[model samples]
Target: MNADTRALLSEAFAIIDGIPDDAIRFGAPRSIKGPTLDDGTVCSPEGWLAQHPRFIERGLRLTEDGSAILYRGEGSASVPAALPMARALGLPLDEARRLFGQREEFTANPDNPLTDKQLWEQRVREVLGKAHSPRAEVQELAETGSLDPHFGHDVPL
Candidate 1:
């Protein structure tokens, strides 16, 4: 990555880290039963995947099958969204599988020393380290002020 891109990524990571934990609603594999939306669509757990696009714009991507999402900033960093979601929702891994079908294959080790936030930061750095075309495109856009600074709003990370 160029120096300018690295600097931009550093600033972006800081902004992400500064967000309050409570502002995020970590997803669970189990379907959350709730009333229909004003548009009359059922609010299923999978519906939550709709939030993935915002994350994608921030250099994360859901698996093509829609089973999992991970940081793509650096050579396909394997930061599974499921593990943290399971922790946040207090669901066991097995239960998560029962609900979501299967756990993502690229999950982090449970005994890893890093906290969730730290892991996230590490993944972000990894993604930034990669020489992906999209990252270059994003950097160009950012330099031109065509991309919003807070493009990750409501992203589930």
Candidate 2:
């Protein structure tokens, strides 16, 4: 990833890590095999989250190779729960969604190595650069309490 996108992701990951356990609702692991990566490394999902804690709400599953996949499936509460992280980072919901979408896409692509964080940096930069006006709209919506209609009012964002 470019320095900027990497920096933003770093910030996002920090916020996710800083969130208290009480603030998060952990989901059951999608795989019964536990948190083994494709390389046969065995780790607990919770342990994995301890280092890469952003997946607490995003939901994680073990790949056949035993790597953890951070995914927000359809009907997942992770998306709405994630809005607060965006708000904390001063990012609009659309921008956050795009970033998360990019992460999902990158994780699913088999052509590249799984650990390549910089592989999708250009795409993330493009998404981040294309938006400038939505922040104002999100701020207005937050101020007017209209965010609930879209992002759900229960979320602190």
Each model's TM-score, in the order given?
0.28, 0.29
Residues 1-157, candidate 1: write the lDDT tens digits: 4565455444444443543432222343212222322122221132233233333454444443334444442322143454433333334545333332222221346566554444445554554555533344555656876545553343333
User: Where does the lowest 10-residue lDDT sum fall in candidate 2?
Assistant: 148-157
RMSD of each: 12.2, 13.5
Give each model's whole-structure lDDT.
0.39, 0.36
Q: Per-residue lDDT for 87 in model 1?
A: 36
Q: Model 1 reaches what TM-score against the true structure?
A: 0.28
Model 1 segments more than 4 A misplaced = 22-107, 111-113, 127-157
Error of 1 at 110 (Å): 3.8
Off by over 4 Å in 2: 1-7, 10-82, 102-120, 128-157
lDDT of 2 by residue, 1-157 (tens): 3554444454333332333322322232222232222222222222233223233334432233322333432223334423433443345667654544333543555555433224233334465455533344445534665333221112221
